[model samples]
Target: MTQATMTQTKVDNGVNVQALIGAREALEATPAAAQFKWRATCQWVNGTHSRSTVNSFFGLGEEQERPRSFTVDADHPEVFAAEDNAPTPAEIALTGLASCLMGGVASVAQHRGIQLYSVRATVEGDMDLQGILGIDDEVRNGFGTIRVTFNVDADASQEEIRALVAQAQKRSAVFDCMTNPTNVVVDVA
Candidate 1:
């Protein structure tokens, strides 16, 4: 489904949130690990209340202010990685993976009429010095991909349970690396 379709729906009680996320998981998962990439727009302010916008959730709830914290890249549209104590880009990526796998499995379980009592995912990544410092060309940068260890509680044989999880991941838009491959269109906004 298109990204617009995903955002068109709103949640008054927040129950429809999962359906919303699942609907646009494909497109939403395309952008970097920004909190929200519905083309978030923020104006600069030297004083308090730095950025404000009508789009997305920014400039709305909480009456918050943009702290001095921010990161800018010469390429791609500028992103608000965090205000002050914002989670690092790497950290956000890990969270996305967890959400994708766990949510995907849950959705599938619903279809199979299986009661998943507990589901947990732990993810880890390694950043080589060269990748971190942007010094080594031979060594690929970023997460070099990631690994996930899923601990699940269910009533199925090991093979059956594993197959179900794998199937869910396949349908998951966020988990499909090749399907929702990220495109870094950078040029600073």
Candidate 2:
């Protein structure tokens, strides 16, 4: 096929397939390029309220800057005896998971030559505040169960849609992080 034909076919589902493939190939050639260190700094605003800022990150073997700084505010609800300023940390976690999975679905669908018309997702995390409140020593501080449902509209069969969502879950970094345990060290600096 001609370059134009290939390019045309690669531009699907609002994703630049050619650019994505090129990035993968380049990263494969230089494995170190895939290593990234994402960083965010949080400062306390008041009781049970804090703000986190994101500006730049280390990726592609170098420091990369974003177009502008982004900030996220976290606070508890009135029922929790705190100001209802913004979403809680737990809600933020759910948002991160949903965003990552949706992004994966788009990319995977594009790679498989599928044209996606629309995709919507609902993510739920079941948490027991007993652990966080130190009311029950046996309870866990994190979510006990997390569920995600996707409603996808595309030029593909139901089986294909299911497979697409499954593949996206398999490839999602946030999904893996939530399901698996990682080393976390905390100290005063």
Candidate 3:
């Protein structure tokens, strides 16, 4: 096959593998270009309800803006003595984790030339409210455990699917952030 034909055949699972490879090569060539800064602003709407907006970020050595602004509302449930405005912060964290892992799975599958028919992820997090309520100092303010189960239909063996998920976990930034300690600074201006 010609070089062009070989390159054209690299597309899989709706991802252009050649482009992915090209991006990696470009980042490797300029290591500083790989640095990215994500930003989000949150505004309090009412009791335990707030909206966070994501419209721009710093990436690839320059400032970048999204094609459209996006906002997410977070609030406590009715049981927490607040309006059920939207998903809770913990739920949003779960969503981020699931999305990050799923994206990794798709990217890995595409690069590996695996044809994916469907992918579904179920994420569950167990947390105790005692810590947040100051009822139990021993309990953590975050999830005690988080579990992710993926149901993927692809043209690959069971072992390959497991390997794909394992690789996704290994490469997932959200997984690393949640599993490891990150320095966070909070101050009122």
Candidate 4:
């Protein structure tokens, strides 16, 4: 059977029963060793256009893995004097944030035995390009503020869902990464 068909068949009460069970088992077995490192490579195409490729899932104990290769393109809008071929980097960052939050929501809901009907997250970031353009030295080139709204339909009380969302935010790696400062070293090759 196809993957979609299998998924549909394995779903129970709006949750993927088999997948959740498997994930729980994996987590239980791995526990403290369940850490993972994700890597992506991006190459500049030309004039505010670039492509990124994601393929591998690396972890502490997994010795053999299949390559799941996919590519995404990023480009600036026409107003920026570039072709609007794909979403800008800032847009992609928001996408990543939304996706990570959604994943957290789903996982937490499943663990709490809450059946999710639908979950959606809207993420917005405010930024000023003056810093990037060297027009304003005091302006930062990154997002000045970001807001996220999550709309979830589930078989659970509003208070429960709110608590779940708070827990998810506390546990979400992307959320922590965005909010907390990290040490980054840049080396020119």
Candidate topping lDDT: 3
Ten residues in a row with the worst lDDT in model 1? Answer: 72-81
lDDT of 1 by residue, 1-189 (tens): 222234553212113445645655854665343234333345644322234343333322223345444432121112433334334556665776778778767766654445566778898877665855568777866666578888877644567568868987787756675247677676875
Clashing residue pairs, backbone N/CA/C < 3 A, model 4: none
lDDT of each: 0.56, 0.89, 0.90, 0.80
Two-way TM-score contest, 1 vs 2, winner = 2
- Tens-digit per-residue lDDT, 107-180, candidate 2: 88887777787999999999999999999999999999999999998766788788889999998999999999
Which segments of model 4 are wrong by more than 4 Å? 1-32, 62-64
Tens digit per residue, CA lDDT, model 4, 2-85:
232334433234556568678769878978647776777899999999999887776755643556778999999999999998
lDDT of 3 by residue, 1-189 (tens): 222234565435777778879999999999999999999999999999999999999989999999999999999999989999999999999999999999999998887767788999999999999999999999989999999999998777888889989999999999999999999999999
Native-vs-model 4 lDDT?
Answer: 0.80
TM-score versus the correct structure, for each prediction: 0.55, 0.92, 0.92, 0.82
Write out the backbone clash pairs for model 2. none
Report model 1's TM-score to 2 decimal places: 0.55
